[model samples]
Target: MRARSTVLAACAAAVALLPAGCGGGEKADDAGASASPGAASAAPGPIPAIKPADVKPLVGRWVGTAKDYFQFTADGSGVWVRGGQRLWSGTAIPEGGGKYRFSWQGGDLKTASYWGVSLTEKNTKLLFAGTNQTYTKAVAHKGKGKG
Candidate 1:
């Protein structure tokens, strides 16, 4: 009779500990819910493609004024102004790798400009590591139209 009680008590202790052990870990459903869909999974629908010509509309003179105003001409030349000082001026040359090299002269500064990939129609951000400045501006065309 004593042996039977001891076995029953041991089994009860194990059953109580089992719930605590399992609950201590993260729940499987929570992990699955937070996971993102696989990138290689089948496409839900056709993806629209943008051609270079479609991007041509973005090529033009864009001007803006706030703390500073800048004029960016995609054709060949561009300029930026702040506090009556011309911050930048140069010729913009577009390359294949979403990059543009600009040869500029103005504001006691002279050098070639480096522009990264275009972000949007109205906004273009440029980073100058030498100056440690990130320039962000909303551009407006001189007369062609709005972006």
Candidate 2:
């Protein structure tokens, strides 16, 4: 249980620093917005089905904050990095129909934790089902045209 708590703490810290990343300066929506105090809010619309092509485009670094991010490689591997250190890595498998299953091996677990994941906002953001966290893709820059 201690291991789970540590992992949860890492995720919490990542969310707590979201206002300062590649997210375009917009405030993050409340993680638990459904429970926010106000007139009852409508449920969010259904997420679009993930496509097989969507898997390839996920091969890059996605950031929630300067110190927290997820990186995926074309070799079907993904890593979660925090505080400039790699925290864990796992296999990313396509379950077809644009859905992906991530089986990560880390911490105290003898088995892997599998989670459904998908891309949103035109593939600019990564969203994991059953969770409110979102990570924005890091934009790549090219060198200035040679003189």
Candidate 3:
């Protein structure tokens, strides 16, 4: 009877330590392993779609500066400059294919014309071309009188 009680006490002590030794780490590892696959399979929400009709009316005059550059326009033709050097002066025309193309004289150099197409939105898109001292810039047409 005495030996049986000693054995039972030893077993109880082992069982108590069992949870402390194995419970926390194994449970955390299993949770982390299972959680990773679930995170990977989760889908991101839908992307916003833009159509040509949505951008048509924006084919007028827009004047705003971006990235420390300034633009001034009358009608669809405009000039852009940065740091007191003229970059380009160009005409913008809607190309009927959800895009607008602009042609302009690049810098003070005659016979140097640059052209590019851009999709219009409530926001403007600015494009930069060339390296170092040689570059061209294009902006989307923004509409109406200034606010």
Scored by TM-score, the top model is 2
lDDT of 3 by residue, 66-111 (tens): 2223242334444444445444344444445434333322111111
Model 3: lDDT to the true structure: 0.33
Candidate lDDT (C-alpha), each: 0.35, 0.52, 0.33
Pairwise lDDT winner, candidates 1 and 3: 1
Instruction: Give TM per candidate.
Output: 0.35, 0.52, 0.31
What TM-score does structure 1 among the candidates reach?
Answer: 0.35
What is the TM-score ranking, best to worst? 2, 1, 3
Candidate 2 RMSD computed on C-alpha atoms after optimal superposition onto the true structure: 14.8
Pick by TM-score: 1 or 2, better one: 2
Root-mean-square deviation of Cα positions for candidate 3 versus the true structure, in angstroms: 29.4
Q: What digit string (tens of lDDT, one per residue) describes model 1 on residues 1-147? A: 775565445434422432221221111322222211121222222112334443343354333322344354434345544455554454334443344443312111122222212324343655332222345555543786675
| Cα error of candidate 1 at position 16, Å | 74
Off by over 4 Å in 2: 1-10, 13-54, 106-116, 129-131, 145-147
lDDT: the better of candidates 1 and 2: 2
